[model samples]
Target: MSEQAAPLRRERRTFALGLLAGVFGLLLVPTCTSCGGADESQAETRPLVLSTIGQIHDIASTLAGDDLRTEVLLGAGLDPHTHRPTRADAARLTAADLVLENGLHLEALLHATLDARRASARPVVAVGESIPAEQRLAVGGAGALADDPHLWMDPVLWAEVARAVARELSDLAPAAAPDIARRLEGVLAELAELDAYARRSIDSIPAERRLLVTAHDAFGYFGRRYGIEVASVQGISTESEASVRHVQELVNLLVEREVPAIFVESSVSVRGPRALVEGAAARGHQVVVAGELYSDSMGPPGTYRGTYVGMLDHNITLITRALGGDAPAAGLRDRL
Candidate 1:
């Protein structure tokens, strides 16, 4: 047989065997279909792993490595809090082998679609929900922010979510468990490094200027983890409207603290922070609009900022610099 046709023949044999094994309720042992030895190329035919957003996609991709094909349901610059799924989204969920999400009310409108799929026995996991309850933050007073869904803001907390995703993927594809575990260990190490960088950089900020004013309350976890005081006009969810009183209060705090800059979240509109700037200026306090921060979503796909590590690095670098902290101009690894 020609070398070019060898892989095709192996794939056919494997498919036939997999069907027979399924009929007998036996697990089919996976093999490297390309060259008769262990190789990751055959993973191109692996199960489909669907994620709700880019952050989760990065986690799933990191864990799955070359063992599975992972994709994100939501694209860049999309707000998960206010996102409403379309018919195509419903179809994607229906066709998913496993659906992963942040899941602390992050995809509020998309939950029903995911639930419908789950009710039918589809493998859908909310990786972020796996975090310990005590570690989770509560939003506003009672109405909103009851459970903060922005866990990715904290590298340590997100490491736990990555582990949960690894377990879920491994359970679904037992043959690839060993590979998944190995990659997960590496991912955890990177996350730990990112966490350490965040701590050291944020700690260097001048104590009095450690105020993080943003468009929304997506940074509560970040604030709690990094020792910055977070203030936002909108509550946890961007769907909530900001009241005049809230804006006024932020303006007052800005003037009182003489905060130099206010940031706008990438996934949210710039109007909130602009209002704060105007309000602060009206009170004779000039608060410049700082750089944008990745909150509910990651950066554009295919960019460094789009990856999980890049997203956090960008945030830490921006926060440190804007708040008068010491950090490299290019961020953690000169990749900013």
Candidate 2:
């Protein structure tokens, strides 16, 4: 291998499951593949590791189970658009049988890296290709935001992504197709239940209170699915900045419309939303911090909101209660 493709070095396994299953390393990426040295049980071919960002990796792991060796390329809280691939990352890619990405222009940075190695790789799966155009939120505005890449925000849409992931993994590792299919069915059913739960939860809130204001424009699909009106300070891509004029406009809307709450995103700064709150307070209109939602990433592991289902459930519960809606002891979330 040349300097551009030299021998790869592996990082030491530094993390163990901790309190509340919270991950201590904010930027941990599972970088190593099997060395063909572990026990025979661990030696079973594992799809060379289906690699993608956090949430997709999480959902696929739940669906694919032990059949796939999953690795998240980006860590929990990094911005995907600006995430650069490290030398270790490139090594993971070259060693893998396949790669998975959201790819509605979501992983813009990774495109260059993938393209460079595509000729020699097994496959690079862009799961979003399977989504029905009408079902997805159409793009608007300029730059990376010119296309809406946050399609995974909606559970229904994400199920489509699961199907594509399973199909690609099955293609790479035929022996696991049977298992992937079985779990894919269960995964789709769970997603539907989640969708219904969110809809009912949002519906229970009075129509006037169904407004969702957040730090970034990652909720377009979500707002369209249920009836919430989503307003984010920044565009879909984290690289985009909210203009001063946009801030003043949002502040004006919050005060004039008297929105009960505004939300902060875990992956981004809350300064913009806080400004809106203060702007509201200055005019005698109070807006409280609703909850920290998983806009671009999931929560700390083992929390009520770590996985995809848990993430949406937490969001629904918070949005409903914060906006004066009620919640049953358990959402009528039934798995098919």
Candidate 3:
């Protein structure tokens, strides 16, 4: 086999094996209806659902309803691409009834730790991998990752992830299947509405100024889904270095298109886009860092921007206003 195909084959094989193992592991969990009312009461206790990122945790928490205790290993603004597993994180990983992750190499540093847990019959799943290969976008850069893990940027695509989370949580807590499925339905409907709002709002931008430039190439999926042209300094993985050539290319595009605004990410350094602005200035073209976007992470907790809906709302609101499109200042539902 060729070098490129080898990894693809291995990934497929691993996923297939993991799927079987996960199902078998679920079967091993004893189901006792003998206690009747007692068992039903205890079922309310819920499982401890651990996720890798806050976004996934939030979605799972919403889907898990009030029953499951969902928590994330990484907090707001942490870059998952380079985050390493600490001793405390490892302890939490083992303690979780079921661990949820983005996968597609998003948690590159924690693969070994997650793998170890899965081998021991602990349920560790990369829910993002549940999105089919055909749906994922490819990115390019020196030493960059092959697939984009930022599926959450697009609500339509994220609905796929929501479905995946519902399946895994249902498997772990069969007694709560009805509740979980009900919540999943509600979440999906909200996401569908959000997707429609995004499409309408983004389409308002003038065709010429609909270009979206950011610090990194995390918006490929977003751009594809929303009908916007995207450019970036770095690759899919934030770990990839930004070359001057790439920056210059983006600067040229900015200048050529006279793109009025670009954006920075909360989790990625502003240095990349900052350089692009300076480079554009040198050539008599001006670009502003219109706003900060939630790329790899979401906003602070207890805030509107912290939730999955809020994250996308912020992106849509910021992009529309900055790109000369019209959107309610507060966003789709005046909830910003």
Candidate 4:
């Protein structure tokens, strides 16, 4: 087999295994009343919204307020790209009154399980798909066009997702429609402020030094929205390994541009970013790993960084400060 074909084959194999596992999980879902199967009484009391990732959970929770119950399947530091559904996850997905996922293959491993749930006539929304096609960034190079799933990286795009979630929540619980709509208004204003803050913070960085290098290509939306150039060691999906040639190319870019700082993702391995630092050091460029950015996940629940606004505030502030820009040490609302 050719070198390129090897990775393609491996990806296909991995995806197949994940699908099989998810199907198996569904089959094993507990049917007994005592085994945590859907309690129709409880579900009717309070609608449960299961979000595939923290970013979606944050938005859903913000719009839902106390009207709905929101929970996240993937936690902080967990890479959704490689996460397979467990038996419990299958049960929750089955029981959820409404399911919200980033879609665009972000939850590639859970696609089969989510599909099964949808096939059963359960409500499942891929909130990221709510964004207009033209607003989404296309990936896959010269091959078939695919939408990048990391829309949450841009606050403006994320606001659209927030609106989508609001609509879903309102539909799920019509009685809460007024409350959801009110909360949605507040969330949209907050996201707009976040977008403006990100642009301002990023603009403060010196133009030549405004490049952001990270472990993976999760920040394309962020860079496009904030006027920074984004390069990564790995592809958009963390499922793909970083190629040596790609690393060397990035090293060359770092050395040639004399870029000061690179970033590591909270949910991704630091080896790739560290390798870039070492590669640049060997060339005497002296690059630093500025700080860990929340890419696939957010911070721990109940904390400031755990929230959607806090997550972006942290990223904007950290990137600005690391790249020699001016930003408040405490971030947008003195929360970071």
Best by lDDT: 4
TM-score of each: 0.85, 0.82, 0.85, 0.86
lDDT (0 to 1) per candidate = 0.88, 0.77, 0.89, 0.92
> Across residues 143-166, which tens digit of lDDT does each residue of candidate 3 receive?
853778888988888998999999
Model 3 stretches astray by more than 4 angstroms:
1-45, 141-145
**lDDT per residue, candidate 2, 183-296, as tens digits?**
889999989988988888889988877788999899998998887899988877877788989988888877776679989988888888888888788888899998788777
For 193-297, candidate 1 gives per-residue lDDT tens digits of 999999999999989899999888889888999899998988888988899998999999989988899899888989889999999999999999879999888
Model 4 scores worst on lDDT over the 10 consecutive residues at 30-39
Cα error, residue 306 of model 2, in Å, equals: 1.9
Q: Write candidate 4's Cα lDDT for 34-95 as tens digits.
A: 45545665455788999999999988988888888889999988899999999999999998
Alpha-carbon runs more than 4 Å astray in model 1: 1-44, 142-145
Per-residue error at 39 for model 2, in Å?
6.0
Q: How many clashes in each candidate?
A: 1, 0, 0, 0
TM-score (C-alpha) between model 1 and the true structure: 0.85
**CA displacement after TM-score superposition, residue 128 of candidate 2 (Å):** 1.3
Query: Model 3 Cα displacement at 136 (Å)?
Result: 1.1
